[model samples]
Target: MRILVVEDDAGIALGLRTNLQQRGYAVDVCASLASAWAALSSEPFDLVLLDLGLADGDGGDLLLRLRQARAAAPGALPDPLTPVLIMTARDQVADRISGLNLGADDYLVKPFDLDELEARMRALLRRAAGRAHPLLVHGELVVDPAARTVLRAGEAVELAPREFALLLLLLESRGRVLSRQQLEARLYNWQDAVGSNAVEVHVHHLRRKLGEGLIQTLRGVGYFIPREDGA
Candidate 1:
């Protein structure tokens, strides 16, 4: 799954990112609310790890803006099922209650264990899925998560292994910026340098077979899959 870590502290953000990466998640780290907003605007993500204290703005306002963004969209791209896990140093009951009221799916106080955080995220994802997996859908596409096959509009779409891998990467990230270097690394080994046109080639094929505007290119940065309306 894709997870966004909105935190200002380098240590905490790195720790969370490393831990989550080890747990088979693709993580994007941002230090300020503005960066976080940029990330959110460009990509789709499965979950968010939001910190109350950010360098650019308050987490409360950020949360409100996120909700407004979703509401403004035609069908709320990320949908209400997308989880937002709040991480804060404040542990007061009022703070927890207020965050929950504001739409946070779960809360974690500072000085917590990474295992606990992972456990909480697993629980949230399970609940979000209605306790099921396989046959993942995004917009008009249906992905057989188990078979690694893709179908769009009821027609089977042939995808290269690399294309399928990249698509799954984007789906797992479903609402976050994925740097080209990051995507390239997934396709190439550590010792091999990814060719300039390799990722573009795979993406081009995927798009031609899938549909135009299926995967959006973020100029100067990377790629993202916009959340579908009502998803």
Candidate 2:
């Protein structure tokens, strides 16, 4: 998934960007509130990791603006229900309450373990996908997004990080076709040097590992995984 990290702490931002990328997520970091707002207005992010304290403006203010924009005109923003998780040094009861009331989906105090942070992120992503359980079933394939494991016919299947991400995205949009541009935007961050056929290469890798017919192409349109009825 693509995530926007709004933080000013250079060390913390670098650590988060590195860790999230290693875990198979496309992440973009913004140091100030202005940059964050600009980023949000430009692209679609599956989730946002926001810091409360900002040098230019308060993160709460940005959160309020986002929610208000969604409420007033949902189409103006990339997603009306874009999830936000606040990570801040504020640990007071009121601060937490205020953040939650301002549209933060989840809150985590600073000085947190990366493991726990990843777990929470998984939970939030699952919730956003409307999945009560972590496992995703497609025919004989069972995918554990949290564990980053895949089982086909009860046998383990190992996939590269990019391949796994592409599979997950295809599964999530089972009946819909995703253009190569959409896939590229969701799979790669700004820093990654992408080849012209990067998405095609990833899709080719997935087809080889999973199955030939698992992912279908539209010739001139895009790619999609067919529904059980083959629609």
Candidate 3:
């Protein structure tokens, strides 16, 4: 999914952007609240990874602004329950409660692993998607989350853990546009589970096995799987 990453630390921001990108997310980084607001205004993002201590202002204010904007322009917005994952150095119980109260979907303490962040993100999105471990089906392509089976054209398509996770995300939202951030969230627990070109590598292999048209890449956005009728 499209993600806006609001962070001030250059190294941390770069690391996040790079890692998320490698995992098949379209990530935009902003070092300050002002830029965060601008990015939020300019384009539609499925989720956000916001750092509280931004250079321009508190991330809470940014969250408030987003809520206010959504309220003001309800019809213009895409996803009403846009997930926001808070990133903060404060790990106190009160701090976590405060962020959640301020409309943050979840919070992560600093020095946390990217994998953990991704898992939390997946949980948030899964809630927004209104399903927990939902099964995905597209024609002969069936992905059973519980069974961990992938079948294309009625033939079983073998996938590694990461590959299965990636396919699950695509099939979960079949016919919907899923930016890389959303996919990255599925791989949160397994950092070394993939290489730099992991998403691309997996997608290539998936297309080869499932058929070239199964997963279509949206230029400058991400990937998707259309329903059988559309195909």
Q: Per-prediction TM-score, please?
A: 0.58, 0.95, 0.67
lDDT of 2 by residue, 1-231 (tens): 889999999999999999999999999999998998888887778889999999998999999888877434643454658889999999999999999999999999998999999888888888887788878899989999888999989999999998898998888888999888888888888888999999899889888888898999988788999878777
Off by over 4 Å in 2: 71-76
At residue 126, give the lDDT of candidate 3: 69
Clash number for candidate 3: 6
Candidate structures ordered by lDDT, highest first: 2, 1, 3
Decide which is better by lDDT, 1 or 2: 2
Candidate 1, run of 10 with poorest lDDT: 71-80
Question: Which candidate's TM-score is highest?
Answer: 2
Q: Taking the tens digit of each residue's C-alpha lDDT, what string does model 1 give over 93-210? A: 9999988888788999998998788878767765665556545788789987445578899888878767886887787667777888768644443234568788888888888998
| Candidate 3 structure quality by residue, lDDT tens digits, 11-119 | 9998998887666565788899887776666556768999998877899998877765543564244333678999999999999999998888888999999878877
Measure candidate 2: CA RMSD.
1.8
Per-residue error at 21 for model 3, in Å?
1.4
What are the clashing pairs of model 2?
Answer: none
